[model samples]
Target: MIESARNLDALKRRLASLDRVVRTRHAHFPFGHAPLDRMLGGGLARGRVHEFFACEGGEAAATGLSLILARLAGPQATTLWLRPSAAARQGVPYGPGLTALGVDPAHLLIGVMQDEGMLLRAAVEALRSPALGALLLEIRGRAPQLDLTASRRLTLAAEQSGVTALLLRLDADPTASAADTRWRVGAAPSVPLPGNAPGMSAFDLTLLRHRGGRDGVAWRLIWDNERGLFGDGRDERDDHGRQGEGREGGAPLSRASLSFPAVRPAADRAA
Candidate 1:
């Protein structure tokens, strides 16, 4: 009888260890930005809900940044983006533009809901799918349906499924929610390329709230589409006025530079 009891305890311990390993694997992934990752306690947490609010005239920037993050979160997994039908007025996603941003259009699925209620319902349901890599819910204006209770529900589903949830809010103010992190995203001038060409996409990001870390920090990030990563928006130039190796903590842009074309997806321009 003592031998059997010992064996049972060993099994229990083994199971517990396995659980820990699984949780660790799904904990978080590095944002590739040194300072930002350090501030986030290693990286952005997976299997949790995060909120991104768009500043004035920055709806496109917020959407673009969120999509980039979703791709990073689950590069091999499919991402489903849910939006209300009314959002069609802003503009639908453009395929070429998405490709230029380093996100493969083939792995993305767009779902247009009839109203906010249906959109939230679909978001919760999508969060329950373990196969899904990331889920993005684009809510415009005041979203009453996404209350504290609804956010909690989404969080629970994400925990069970190990999927990251990104909420993009346009024309809305921050409200109470169970989000792990809240950010305000706006467009920033990009570095001009040779021959006065438009450079990569840039964003001015502000961390409004972080659940277990510091907040009210800001960072300027430049998206490197070719590498599918983000830089510190400090692009170095060589002697010939060509681009050089980029490093963090470089000098900020001195003058107004070009930004991404306004014809991209989720942009303010009419489709």
Candidate 2:
């Protein structure tokens, strides 16, 4: 048992030393998308921060994003849902949706705060402790007036402690951030039917920014509404998120079969 434990520790140490692993890759959890993992060189760099900005008025992208975060949250790590707007927490069925993504409600620490500063404080607090896996902050159209000095300080603290900080800004401006990696996700066609049937609600994950990777051409993903799962695509081979090089930039968009509700713009009527 002692020998086994020592081997495990050594492996963990190697994983911890991964430059990107600290922000995205962690042993406990798997990447949201297998393809995305390839792009991330594993997964979201653990102990690093990734900022997701939802400029779209509605959270048409949220359902898919939820699954991503849930996948990132390992069994041992905790997800701190901080300062969600009324629509996000009360109006939208987040807990249920998250449950569908395999994230247990019991493991989520949701806090409804009134201001952005409080949310920042919570991020700082969560980063102070290495036990945390990921922190998801749902902002209500916030201004990007956070202290950069403080944010940099927190980044350093996260490096020392080993925690991933995720910022989800709904209906917020894209320029309102100074994070490590920034991304924007939108709803696309889910899984296509057997034949002429329409596809369900799926996602189009756009990599707005990455530390070291090519930009442009978003990855199209299918969403499994019932099972709360994400499908790779019409093709079976590429379960991973690999960019098809020869494929044209703007592929013809197939119309979806299911009729999902129109998402409203993200507003700031939070707790």
What is the lDDT of every predicted structure here?
0.73, 0.53
- 230 Cα displacement, candidate 1 (Å): 1.1
Worst 10 residues of 2 by lDDT: 1-10
What does candidate 1's lDDT look like per residue over 1-271, in tens digits?
Answer: 0011012234233223321112237478766777678779877899999999999999888988898899888886667787787675557676666777777776776667777887787777777666667888889989988899999999999888788999999999999999999999888776678997887887878888999788877666777777777764463222222223233345444322325542343544333
Question: Which stretches in model 1 have alpha-carbon errors above 4 Å?
Answer: 1-26, 232-271
User: Which structure among the candidates has the greatest lDDT?
Assistant: 1
lDDT of 2 at 16: 42
Candidate 1 whole-model C-alpha lDDT, 0 to 1: 0.73
| Model 1 TM | 0.80
Highest-scoring model, TM-score: 1
TM-scores of the models, in the order given: 0.80, 0.66
Candidate 2 residue-wise lDDT, 1-271, digit = tens: 0011112234244334323322334433434456556666765666666777664743646634643564455443455556534544445334444544456655565555556665566567656655555666566565564546756765776677777677776777666344666777666545447885655655556677776765544665555555544444442212125544444453444443232342223352222
